[model samples]
Target: MEMSNMPLGGHWVLVIIMIILATWVIYRYLAPQNAKEWRNAGLIQGFIIALYAEMYGFPLTIYLLTGFFGLEIPWLHMRGHLWSTLLGLGDVGAMIEMIIGLGLVILGLLLLARGWSQVYKAQKENRLVTDGLYTYVRHPQYTGIFLILFGQLVHWPTILTLLLFPVIVVAYIYLARQEESAMRKAFGQKYVEYMKRTRMFFPEIKNWKLLFKKG
Candidate 1:
């Protein structure tokens, strides 16, 4: 029952509800720290809005697939689970993937929340956040965002999202570099030494012991 193809057609009300829920989450957990932070937040919000809008209000990718690419699957427009439909994964397989995706989203959000908590406290104390998730990845928040997007892609796999995903990743990489420059100015040699130990995004398995100890 949970894996049955979604009801045929879009649901504007559901889309609006999801957007409102997302807005509240961003407001409560991801409040921006400065002009640059606010701009980054806006960029993500814009991407999410476009994502969900098409997710429930309009199936643009499915439309393009059927309209231009000559997809002839009957009721393709009705079932909104595009990934399952496209891959011929029955409802059960799709449900399993959905569960994994949800777990990934939860893990990603936890990392983001924990990183934010540590950073907020560190900012107040004028101390660097090198413990917790930062012990491995210099940018746990960005890593978290990437994980979240990846989970979404696992379930959705829309062409529009696939195209935007790389662009968003590049943007975040550029933003992370800009952030590192400021950190260098603020912490000087200390920050440089930290960089030598930590990577920008992915965690070093070699530092797993350090992260476990610090965490």
Candidate 2:
């Protein structure tokens, strides 16, 4: 996977545009309520900037690692996909990255779409969203976003983004708490009952049979 002499790939404009478009989509079709919730979007955009900037504009992590650690880590390798080069899997690494990234991304977007759709319908009818994807997890939208951020890290693990990942997780966790507090006020005992039954972020594996039976 050593391609020290190779020129950098993954153009900056395309990556920037992709991030902008992603931000737009997140705001439009899959937005969370309140200004506090919007902070997640801002953090996500920061991650994207750090991610693609290194991904295309510069190999900051690679350079830093090679400079500080004095390890000859195949500079300019794998088009700034450090994870691939570091693993020494070469093409296999690239394929694994693509597969994992794509899988998580598709799953994330699907969850976001379905979760939001359910929420919208519930809101229209003046009911709390307790069915569909919400039956398994209280915050499928946040979970979707979490998956997307992790997926990007898997695709290309830059230093900045790796650091930003946990921050993003904590931000989402806080946001989820805030969201749940609001939901509790709106729905009262019903939401409390739902909370007692369902977990946030992760579904209960113990309820697999019941989940299979869900509509």
Candidate 3:
């Protein structure tokens, strides 16, 4: 593949814009309330920056693959869709992956937003939030984060992001456990009952329809 005609780098502006936009949406919807939440948020911030930095600002993964592994990937921006490229699916596969990835991102954002709204209102009333998304998952906002990050992974896979993904998941899982401990203290047996009924992250199959319905 000829590399001279297809440029691969110098897209820092797009990189900056994407990072800022993604971080803003994340902070806005899933606003961190304390030190722990903020720490987890920082991990996500780093993930976004590293993901976009490689995606637009540089093609480190492509370079590493071509130079170190001796692969012959073209240096086109579209070639950044590594999964499709590796799978030999070409442009059409990239488009399909992008559409699916974007769909997951949108769904994650909706879940984050709705979860935030409900939790905020419940906090004001000093009540437990076990309705709406909370009816399904004990930690819907975290699930949203999972979805968004997974979506980004599908859209554009990078070494750094791949490494950070599981770390972020583990961090959120720990955070969720800490949160549950507090909720258990605050709500006593009521929260215990809720926990018994609702799964921590994944929703039950029978209650799937309730996810689409308004709370």
Candidate 4:
């Protein structure tokens, strides 16, 4: 369903419901209590809600400019299938981008799931994680989010979304850095040693091969 249709065809009532639901979902996932974590989580939640709202709730910018776009533009059809409109795809290309975007979304979700599971397990034992997805990126959760957002952008590049993309990207990058600082402080010299061997967002091939080398 188009995001704008979340309120059932620009219905204000439905939009309110979506806002409530989004708030609940973000609160649950972010789980922020303290000041710092709460602030960070708020930023994350805001980014998520903003993206989804524009994605499925309402393409207001698109609709508002339809008159200027000409009568034969078929804005309704495009709004109904919002992603297709943004990606500039016609038929097969649209299908391809949609499939790819869906794939990336699934992959991002899986990465998040796996990363969360690992962290939860470590916390249960009061240990630190330096393996699995963590071995590849210091912040797989943020990376997954970026991947998901990128996938969405590729699938649908609306004016509002496009404008917000860079800002969102910068914000996430800042958050990731903040998280790394906390982690480094906690892990101390061990983390310092690990940093020498790990890349923040990209995996080092030599390290990967060494870590996976067969005895």
Candidate 5:
């Protein structure tokens, strides 16, 4: 079948499934508790919708690239892997990028799960969580979110998603700061000291091994 004539869109079922799965994972693990967290989660929800809509429901990005920009690209679903297509990597290259993206998504999920586990335990004890993923970054959940979003971008670079990526990043950073402010009020000097010792998002290079360490 010709790439242009191949079934390129109307996969609403797949899109809905992806959105539901992504949103479920986000809410289940992150468990946004406040308005700020909810707002950030909304942004992620928008991102997920835009991503899958383009990935399955409609190839708007592909359409624009080939139609508006006059790029000589095919309209096949596989050809929608723009990064691999643009990089001239072909099918093998697309597979490689997909693998890398999947790896990142898995890592991000692990971080979210581990961070939630530690935080849930600490909350039960009414103490600050400063072990496991928390020992590395002050906001491992946010870090995981970034990783997941970036992984999706790497896997499929759609126009809408590419634009939304940085906006989501900024929103999460703001939300993280707001959460930290509340943490300071709740934990006082202890949180202040933790902030001093730990980075907000990224972990220190030397402490990278702790991410693999089992608690």
Candidate 6:
């Protein structure tokens, strides 16, 4: 297909449907019942909204930087699917990106489900959760978000969304630190012990590996 002949509007429609599905999933299944501090909720909500807007709505970043993309790419056109443009691939190549993107989507949902289950169970009983995915990462839900964004980056990679990637990482780091302080205060020595045993984002493979070592 000729560069100018490719249809892009359909891609936007797909993005819109995906965003709605994401919002519904979070609100219906993952939203916390315990009263979340307004500030923390607000920050998280803002991040989600920003991500959805660019992912589905106007796509400002893609539109604004059309020239650079157009000039740099020879066979591709800005009027094509945004994913293809950002990933620097053709239609067939974008099929691969879509497959990868879908895998990330499933991974994100699974992580979110696991994290939410742990958090909810703990919150209901008024206790700390340090098991399952929590045993693997202190903030699996945040990790889930990061993975979802990573997938979207692979899927779309618009300038605005791409720029927001590092911002999301830094924001999550700060939020995680603040959350840890609160968790530590709530759980005290137990949390301290858990912290000693667990690495925040990366796993402590040496210690984990020892569990499987033969005597």
* Steric overlap count per candidate: 0, 0, 0, 7, 0, 0
Candidate 5 lDDT, 1-215, residue by residue in tens: 76535676799999999999999998998898888778878888999999999888988998898899998667777666888888898888888999999888888888888888888999899888887788779998888889899999999878888898999999988888888999999999999999999999998788877775777
lDDT of 4 by residue, 88-207 (tens): 555556577768877776666556556666778787988788887777777666655566667766665556656666766687677668777877899899988877877775467655
Model 4 CA deviation exceeding 4 Å by range: 1-8, 11-30, 51-57, 68-73, 77-88, 204-215
Cα lDDT computed for each candidate against the true fold: 0.74, 0.77, 0.88, 0.61, 0.86, 0.64
Order the candidate numbers by lDDT, best to worst. 3, 5, 2, 1, 6, 4
- TM-score for model 4? 0.71
lDDT of 6 by residue, 1-215 (tens): 76456433335676667666666766654464444433434444455555556654655555556665553332233333466645677667767887897688677766777677778888899888887776767877877767777887776566655666777678668868988998888888999899887777645665443322322
TM-score of each: 0.85, 0.85, 0.93, 0.71, 0.92, 0.71
TM-score of 2: 0.85
Residue lDDT tens for model 3, 1-215: 56334577778999999999999987998789899999999999999999899888888888898899998777887766888989999888989999989888878888888998998899899888888899889998998899899999999888899999999999999999999999999999999999999999878888766765676
Determine which window of 10 residues in candidate 1 has minimal summed lDDT.
72-81
Please estimate how well model 4 matches the true structure, expressed as its whole-model Cα lDDT: 0.61
Name every residue pair that clashes in candidate 5: none
Which one is best on TM-score? 3
C-alpha RMSD of each candidate structure in angstroms: 2.9, 3.4, 2.7, 5.3, 2.3, 5.4
lDDT of 6 at 69: 51
* lDDT (C-alpha) at residue 171 in model 6: 68
Q: RMSD (Cα, Å) of candidate 5? A: 2.3
